[model samples]
Each structure stands twice: as C-alpha cells, then as structure tokens.
Target: MLNSVNRKVFLLYPNLIGYARAALLLLSVFAFHVGLLRFAVGSYAVSQLLDAVDGEVARRLGQCSEFGAALDMIIDRVSTIALYFAIAAKSARAGLLIFLLLLGDVGGHWLFMYTELKLGESHHKNSAHLPPGLKHPTSEAMHQKLMIGGNP
Candidate 1:
C-alpha cells in the first residue's frame, strides 16, 4: 500500500495562477508605456479572465485561504484603479466620471468589506448585521450581477 500526503506550499496552484495574472497586469502596463495599445488591452483582458479562474481553481482544489482571498481582492482593486486612471488620462471631460466611478467602486467595496469584517460575517454571505430593509443576498451573486449586468 502507498500513502500520499498533500503538503501546501506558498506557491500553490491557485496562488500561482494569481501570480501569473499579476505578471500579465505588469506586462499590460509595460505595453501601454511602450505605446503598444492593442497588446496592452489584450493582456489586461486575459488577466481579468485569470482572476475568475483563480477563484474557481481554489474552490476545486480545496486550496482556498485567507491570504489568497485578500490578495485577490487587493489585486482587483489595484487593477480597476489602474484601468480607470488610464481611461481618465485620455481627456479632461472623462476624468470626472472616472473619479466618481473610482470612488463608488473602490471606496464602496472597501467600506462593505470593512463592515462585513467588523460584523464577523463572511464577506460574501448574508448575516445578522445586514442593515434594515436590505434583502440578504449573497455578496457573490450581487457582485456577479453588478459586474455583468445580468443574472449570476
């Protein structure tokens, strides 16, 4: 009989996927700097797709961790901010909207996450601390709807 044990490493599969996504993000930034706009946009697009893949991989491999989740969230915020900044740089007229969008998207999400932490609830789940008159929908589903403008 042979016995096998699973040993977790700092560079787990899901985390590796995250690292790759981060690399792609960096590549996109470099491409943009070098005026390769098409390549930059394409790389950024792939990196966004990898973000979802990492979460799915974590779930399937039972490798989810607090560090991974937090890292993912941080990366998401940074990427969003960077993208918005790039868009805003194109014209002054669009800058105001980008600023408002950044405030709403980044600031709002941070506040929501902070509230969930303080209330001792999983950030994605409904909990007793939910504000009055608000329906208790899972954060995951709400996020999906908000992101894609459709049902999760």
Candidate 2:
C-alpha cells in the first residue's frame, strides 16, 4: 500500500499551504537572484509566517499528517539554507561562516531525523530517545522547553 502517498494528503489545507510556501520560497530565491530584494523579503516573510500557520491550520482542520509535517520540515530547512546561500553570495568575507553554519544546520538536522526514523517515530519531531547533546539546533529540539510532552 502506498500509504503515505495514497492518502491524498497533497490536497490537505496544511499541505497545500506547504506547497504555497515552497513556491513562495522559490520565488524569494529567484527574486533575490534577479536583484529584487524587497520582493524577495516580502515573499520570504510570508513563507515564514505560513510556516507557523500550517501547523495551526493542520491542528484546527484535523489535517495533520506525517506528510504535511515532513513537508513543513523539508521546506523550512531548504529555505533557510537558500537564504544562507544568498547571504554568502553577497558577503564575500562571510562565505566560510555561512558554510560552517549551514554545514552544522543541515548535518545536525539530518542526524536527528535519521535517529527519529530508526526509532520509528510517527512524528519525526520527537527527540526523547536521543542524548541531550544530540538535539539539533535547527530541529524542534531547541524548542523542547516550550513544547508539551518533551523531556524535562
């Protein structure tokens, strides 16, 4: 059964929002590339706002799913890294810093996701199984304190 793909989650309101976010993110990057900073910023800001809105929309609409959550996560990281690339493109001096930051950003999130998948976490955001230090900065681990049901 092609469960994850067959659920028609691609049409869920939250997932649709995710698609919009992805499109807006691409628009932001392209706008930045084409020397449209204001447009890029506006698009990026809306995407970020939709990031927060998607979860709430999912919760309220009873539309939350692994697919939507995963979509949210993937886009969040991709957009952030894209912004870092934009910054690196502009600041010749901070290229190395951006490189290191993104390296850690991507690496840490990857490790955390790998761990979550190995443990069969239905929700990849859970992190109770990991060591204290392994909680990734870019992942929900940073919000452990603010999140309900997180390890105390």
User: Which candidate ranks first by lDDT, i.e. highest?
Assistant: 2
- What TM-score goes with each of the models? 0.74, 0.76
Candidate 2 per-residue lDDT over residues 1-152, each given as its tens digit = 66776768889999999999999999999999999999999998788777766776787788888788778878978987988998888889998899898898889877877777888865554467756675434334325434532222
User: RMSD to native for every prediction?
Assistant: 6.1, 5.8
Residue pairs clashing, model 1: none
lDDT for each residue of candidate 1 in 1-152, tens digit (9 for 90 to 100): 32342334347787888888888988998888789999999998888877766776777788877667777777787788878877876666898899899899888877877887887875433456756445334335435533763111
Residue 4 in candidate 1, Cα distance off native in Å: 19
Weakest 10 consecutive residues of candidate 1 by summed lDDT = 1-10
The lDDT for every candidate, in the order shown, is 0.72, 0.77
Q: How many backbone clashes does candidate 2 have?
A: 0
